[model samples]
Target: MPINLPNNQARDDVLAGRPALWLNPNLKQDGIWDTKLPVRPSRVSEAESNWMLIASLLEKCFPELKATGGKIESALIEVSPMREALGYSSSEFGRIFVKADNDLPVAGSIQARGGVYEVFMYAKALAESQGIISSEKEVDRLVSEEANALFSKHTIAVGSTGNLSLSVGIAARALGFQAVVHICSEAKDWKVDRLTRLGVKVVRHNADYSGAIDLARAQAEADINTYFIDNERSQTLFFGYSAAANELASQLSKAHITVDDNHPLFVYLPCGIGGAPGGASYGLKAIFGNAAHTFFVEPVQSPSALVHMMSGSSEQVSVYDAGMNNKTEADAIAVPRMSEFVAEVMKPLLSGVFTVVDDDLFRWLWIAQTQQSIRLEPSATAGFAGPKFIVNSPQGHAYLEQHGLREKIANATHVVWTTGGAFVPEEQFTKFMERGASLVKDS
Candidate 1:
């Protein structure tokens, strides 16, 4: 099948690395809430249960988890100050909140939700299969010497541009499992150094994220003792991310927020290969149904999910095929291609995707830091553009009118899911702040 995009303009804009918004024409209001998808909402409950089972082990291993009793979660904070700084009043963009995954415990990034959960799930399964801990009561024995020895005989592997590697490597090493991270060239030196310091083997790749993942998967397949956490097709990883929706639902309820027909909910997630955002969108749709509209944010040069989904093709497509260089300051999400599994799952669920330039990301980063004291990396700030696109753009107005949401604009709730930055080194963070300040001044 050919890559048939809806418009030549969008194709050209994407190829030229110019920011663009691509809405999903295949988005369905009905039947998209099906529980039989590749990763179901019910699996989210199971993932939550699994997290509880390993709570004790996580607490023993990671000091950060001690305060939360081993629960991997982040705050849903109201960013009124930051929202005002963006120059949008309440009536135009509604109440804005930031899903602060940047400050998540342990991994200090959104990958803590998926990458850490996947590692924990694998360890629990391996222990149970080997009769090391047959019951939930004995699950704490996973940290014991006997279980450590068994875990030492095996390895957990993943390929990432940055954050996922940190989450997976940190969790795997904590459980005494040998960890191997195949990192792409775009991955930051700080992330690589962090992983190496944790005693994890770092395999550097000269290619992009997809290439690193391919080589990692192939290498892991040859070694029976090694388990590859495939970001492209792993249901475990997807389910791990889906559980965050449940957390968000609870938070919304506690905050006296109402998400209904009149008071709609809009969530903007920063996307990479699409696993994190796709899983979160799926879970959100399952809980809030048509009331929740989810959008994915991507770098202008690395809009892998946008390009592939916009093409309306099941066949995997790369940004390179569209003449994109896939280079961006948002290193973590500089993916050449998206996860095919995620594209298929999001076909009917995703509302749309929008691209952001690196400069805007820097400007938003500066605003977030100065106004609300929120520290975020370039990739994480991509979601800040979501509310403006939804409220101010012509395409956005059309979508709202089509969905009868034009009258409901004032009552909407918007959440910008920030992905990472907590673990950014002080010097690197200073550099980010400087660049952001310069960009803000020039703007």
Candidate 2:
């Protein structure tokens, strides 16, 4: 609660998504990363070795979330139709495509997986610290009974770019918590209204995602009873996302992809608030050690993280642990600040580099449609945009050759991670289904 939450006056009129005449910074030669984040110790821990934390998750978080039934549902497709242009399929690897059915989720956001687990984890931890439980398990079971019994009595708050925030509201409601999602005015009014109808207290902040986050964080600090489930910064949230990577690795096993030492994986993943990649990177590296390589992708327009990486003031890859700032977006992946862990725990994960892509987001959408058969939102495309830009660039092409990046991925598999926008309305879907097709007549 350092800075005051600006009044709601004229906040409703804040124009977002438009390019501003802000001071521009150099985009190459470690400019963004070096300027924004100075190197720090990695906060990520190695696999299964952190039993105390794992046990805490079981005792404090999962128990309640499990009791509520699967709040984080999965949606699966036979293959992403959009993958057609890219030329890949589940059939390529011999009929092995066991994956999380993300389309089955209520909000079409995988963040639901982490959000629910985070709430109970916080509750369990708070209770334990307050002497409600001498150990993690007591709080774990108590969280289940307590969450189910009076979930509605408590209020949960989150700041998101549609998916992550929406997931928090839906999961909170199911678990009996009064959900509140704070969003920037630049977000689609339709999505904001939908949240309101769901009984989620949707607060439209004058600023972008980062501004809303500042508001949410301040509010959470002031009110003890108000539980905040930050998909952006909390330690528990990382563990939650690690589950997704774990499941993905399990699926890769069915494809005969040996995830062993020397056969390490070079995963190019999406970053939004740096939660998924940070947590997943930590998890993969922990379990696989030298057997895994993870590359984080950010949007060129929203290079807050890259900026931090280059700056000397910050300790990690993001500013979340410190605070938030004015934010820009590719929408879904827009975040002004990031979890401090990205600097500390997730810092050692510099095994791979970070890259941003051009604005061919919609093209990637069509690519998703034609190739993998999944219609991802523009923000989702931001993830793919990174690798696409690299492979397409002359310098990047040379770098790839120099680093042997083009080496035919041996038993190598890639997950583009179409991260959000799974539930586009019928009108939107119709538009997506016919995005770039030409009419033909054979008279």
**Which candidate achieves the best lDDT against the true structure?**
1
* Cα-lDDT of candidate 2: 0.53
Q: What lDDT score is found at residue 93 in candidate 2? A: 25
Question: Which tens-of-lDDT digit does each residue in 1-443 have in candidate 2?
Answer: 22221222111111122211111122222222234333211323322223334344443333443542433434323344444444344332212121333353556655655665576555555555556568744544544655455555668898887777776776566555788888876576657777787789998888767678888889887987788876556776676666665556655675566765324355555666777677666666655664555556655545444445434234433433324333433576776565665644545443433444333555556655665566566566555543333444443355445445555333434445566666667676566445433211110
Q: Model 1, stretches more than 4 Å misplaced?
A: 8-12, 34-36
Per-residue error (Å), model 1, residue 343: 0.9
Candidate 2 error regions (>4 Å)? 1-84, 87-104, 123-149, 260-264, 312-329, 351-359, 386-411, 431-443
lDDT of 1 by residue, 1-443 (tens): 24667765556667667777777888888777563456556776787788787788889999878888989889999988766678776677889999999899999899988998899889888999999988889988889899999999999999999899999999999999999999999999999999999999999998889999999999999999999999999988887898889899999999999999899999999999999998888888878989999999998888889889988776888888667788899998899899999998888889999999999988998899899888899999898888888888777887799789998898999999999999999899989999999988987
As a TM-score, model 1 comes out at: 0.97
TM-score of each: 0.97, 0.70
lDDT: worst 10-residue window of model 1: 32-41
Candidate 2's error at 276, in angstroms?
1.8
